[model samples]
Target: MVRGKIQMKFIENESSRLVTFSKRKNGLLKKARELSVLCDAEVALIIFSQKGRLFQFSSSNMENTIEKYLEHGKEEETTTNNTEVQQHVQPLKHEGAFTAKKIEFFESSKRKLLGQDLGTCSVEELHDIHIQLENSLKTIRARKAELYKEDIKKSKAKEKFLFQENTRLRKQCGRKPNQTPEKQKEIASCSQRTVSLEVVTDLFIGLPPFQ
Candidate 1:
């Protein structure tokens, strides 16, 4: 292991700095590859040369390594935030179960606000998340609506082509095919029920009482 505390001042000699950077870059890459192969770890390195060009390396996929780094950082941040919360709430530890749980809930929210460990969130925290989801969905839906007009026009053109074909087929057969009223009603009812249930569940999950 190359371990030392190096001075922070800039190396004024351009040749020396360039040589040092080249040597250290090779050493860093060697260490990264060895760690990845030996421990089954992923590594990503991003360096900018003195000339401002980018140099990058990855043991696996660069995107995967970067995402893993972000996720690991979030987990570390969540743990650190939770520790801070614990210290703040330590005086409430002697309180009853209900109060202790409320403290836990707030602490968990703090973690979520910090974007850490959102996977372990409770039902109440999930409700809070659902609210954020709804706001995001609203923005998405607005953009989708703008795109949907063009989609509708394309669908209508396809429908017209299909209708012309159907007309030609009906003229040849001298008969029209129809869906039975009972089957149509059943399909309509099922679709309505599915939509209603989805809406109800979304509302139920994000209710303020749970929060």
Candidate 2:
């Protein structure tokens, strides 16, 4: 048979309230035990009567379960606190941090390279900076020379292609072709020089010192 929902109110009579509390407390404990056993879950429940009577249940050792619960709660609290701190601190950039110090060091080094701050540098440090500048200059010059050679090679190839086209056009127009063997030999020699330049490495190419 279907029964209407029970009214939600405190039991006013002292005897009825005690009986109700005993029945409901036992029912709740039974439910907790069933849940733990049926779902293979850990469950704990604690009850206090109006007279300060204590009732408790646990799927395992009650002390151990309570300790585990407290530990888990503390960990969650720590995680939440850490998240809040990060959220607030990130917007503030936590000025004067390690990363900020590193950036400042890099900027100081850059200024030194630009010759803006030399008062703090010693003679040995100055010599090291000078060596660094020399190495950088050599690399820059090497790259520039490589690009210049490439441009020259491309220009020569384009010139040769255009000359061949001009010769073909001249023959079609019944004009004497001006591509003589000497001109062809000069073009071939120029191409060979470009190829030789491309082969030249940045290594020292001088005779050994005399003993």
Candidate 3:
């Protein structure tokens, strides 16, 4: 008799599930090691079990592999951003321009902004460009001021909230607060009394003195 192929579904029984996990985990690690040895490749494998038990393997140090992966990802991101350079300018007065004309306009404007190919620009065009730059600078400054004000407002609100919370917590815990009129009032109104816990017998049955 030949063994049947196992179905591709989760094992329901706990014992069977654990056995399968152990076998597969070892097999996967063995394969990773074999591939790294056979191909001289840098390989990193990480596994987390249902219980959060971690297993990892790396051709080299795991930390070094992680650093290399991060560096490579960063370099790839930079390259992708560098490849997606687009030159956009404000739309021309004639919105019905052809695609080629729009592209030409954008390229020309980009060059002008970069201070290149300015020989063909007339005095009026140069003046217009100067006005646009001045307006752009004004807009940028306005936005920066708005952001600064918003950030400062948020910081002030946060500081006020934290101080209030600290005061409330201190009062709740009956702890002395920083020197202030309220702290002085609290200290002044407070009084301490010694508590006597002695017990006296009140079961005396003897006759009292005759009146």
Candidate 4:
């Protein structure tokens, strides 16, 4: 008859739990021995009881076998850790090199902007720089033209003020307003003739005392 599957769990009763532990420990050791002899393999097993008792089995010296297992595990762990480090370091090295090259390119470009280190530039690079310079010069000239226009406006204002002052002074001196250029020349000549007549009158008065 096919038997029902038993639900596996800890035996609750202390007596039954102890009984089960003894039986399972012996069975496990017996199986280890059988497997070692049948397969011609080294075997080791260890068990701890609920009461803190130790039970163990080994095909060879138990201490040496345990030590060998531990050493082998440590060697495998070390190798795995080294492999992981190499995998991570390889990508980091590539990234560092890429970053360094980018920084170098930026520094070289900066040098070029400052008009330094131009000896090794190719013809195309020089042409590009010339175009940039030409655009900058155009901007500068446009700014200069604007400044020149402002200065011309200021000069016109100053000339207007001077002309107004000259006209006021001429009016104060009893000169006619809006006289033509020819009329101005005639006035100057009449003023000169009056001065000559005064000088001759002074000379005749002084000559009578001399006679």
- Once superposed on the true structure, which residue ranges of model 2 sit more than 4 Å away at CA? 1-84, 87-96, 180-211
Best by lDDT: 2
Cα displacement (Å) at residue 171, model 1: 99
Q: Kindly list the per-residue Cα lDDT of model 3 for residues 1-211, writing each as its tens digit.
A: 9999999998899999999999999999999999999999999999999799999999999999999999999999988776664212224324536777989999999899778899999999999889988999999999999999999999978876777788788999999755554565676656322223344556757886578
RMSD of 2: 20.2
Give the 10-residue window scoring lowest on summed lDDT in candidate 1.
Answer: 199-208
- Residue 47 of model 2 has an lDDT of 95
Candidate 2, residue 124: lDDT: 93
Instruction: Work out the TM-score per prediction.
Output: 0.38, 0.47, 0.39, 0.55
Model 1 TM: 0.38
Write down the lDDT that model 2 would get: 0.90
lDDT of 3: 0.84
Off by over 4 Å in 1: 1-9, 93-211
Model 4 residue 146 lDDT?
100
Better of 2 and 4 by lDDT: 2
- TM match of model 3 to true structure: 0.39
Worst 10 residues of 4 by lDDT: 199-208
Cα distance off (Å), candidate 4, residue 115: 4.8
